[model samples]
Target: MAAPTPRALRRGEISFKLDERTAHSSLDLFKKDTSVIYRIVGIDPTKVPQNIERFTDWAVVLGDTAVSSGRHYWEVTVKRSHQFRIGVADLDISREGCIGVDNHSWVFAYAHRMWSAMLANKTTPISNIGHPERVGVLLDYDSKKLSLVDVSKLELIHSIPAEFQGPVVPAFALWDGELLTHSGLDVPKKLSGN
Candidate 1:
């Protein structure tokens, strides 16, 4: 197969990065492999810290800012050895429960040899993906649409319409063997008419 062409961003595409302070206060629940990468090898019960609460599953982190209106885009590179979930969540999303099991987050996850989008207890399988190495997120708050792109192949993995009740922030979860690399952050382009 031929190499996939890089995708061109539409006007007004905005970007962001992870905010360490707001990254689920329990982020230390997992381990940070590098400055911008993390590994979730499961929390050690015996070593649990006093102030940090233990999560039954998954380690989550959020981006720096809460976006209420705009077209935002960001990309994360996952090593592909294990599963990962990436998307946006309402500012008040719970840090204790599984990310997508609640109403405040919308995430696209890859695990158990499959890709799926989850929102409020619903898991919708997105077929035909084979362990994407990098994922791109395109969030349109005005349209209430969130789309995930397979960056390596330049393919749209899934696009779901969501009701983002308020300001939303970029969030992600990591599992064993997953190394998340924050790829790029785009500045919101000025629109011609706006």
Candidate 2:
């Protein structure tokens, strides 16, 4: 029998600043070296500027932002297969400081489609949390699944299945002592994962 292949390490990355718009510049998640930025389309850390080309890690372009170890806020876009990810981070670029501040710029990239091109890669592509205490849980388009994980620990907290509608992306909210979401479909289902 053939030996099983080991799970590949999912590399995430992002360029970030402490407060580009609301406050001064800083990367709180900074540790010793640059951290990988992941993807999360719709969630907290809202009102970010649009139309900026997603950060390129494999790009050969000059002057691209370098990965640093520190705390920083960013707009994360998950790009494992489609390469459509964006976000910010405060990296430590040092590679020596292992412990990081991680105000939680470590973005999450999930999809409703289980067979999404991104999933083909090794990374879990977690969703970004909305606040320091809140989380960023999104629906995968391919797999039609929902997962909630801690942005700091990168632990899978919750997960559920959901399908894709059309142009409208699924938006989640907590109400009536339950977690419900607008499925971006005509008849939205009241989803509550146990």
Q: Estimate the TM-score of every prediction.
A: 0.72, 0.23
lDDT, model 2: 0.25
Kindly report which residue stretches of model 1 are placed more than 4 angstroms away from their true locations once superposed: 1-15, 22-58, 181-194
> Total clashes, candidate 1?
0
| Prediction 1 TM-score vs. true | 0.72
Q: What TM-score number comes out for model 2?
A: 0.23
lDDT digits (tens) for residues 20-91 of candidate 2: 111101111122211222223222234433212222122100112322221111222222322222222222
Which residues of candidate 2, in runs, are more than 4 Å off? Answer: 1-132, 170-194
lDDT of 1 by residue, 37-133 (tens): 3434433544554223223344676665567787777776666456668888876666577677788999998889898999998999998777776
- Clash pairs detected, candidate 1: none
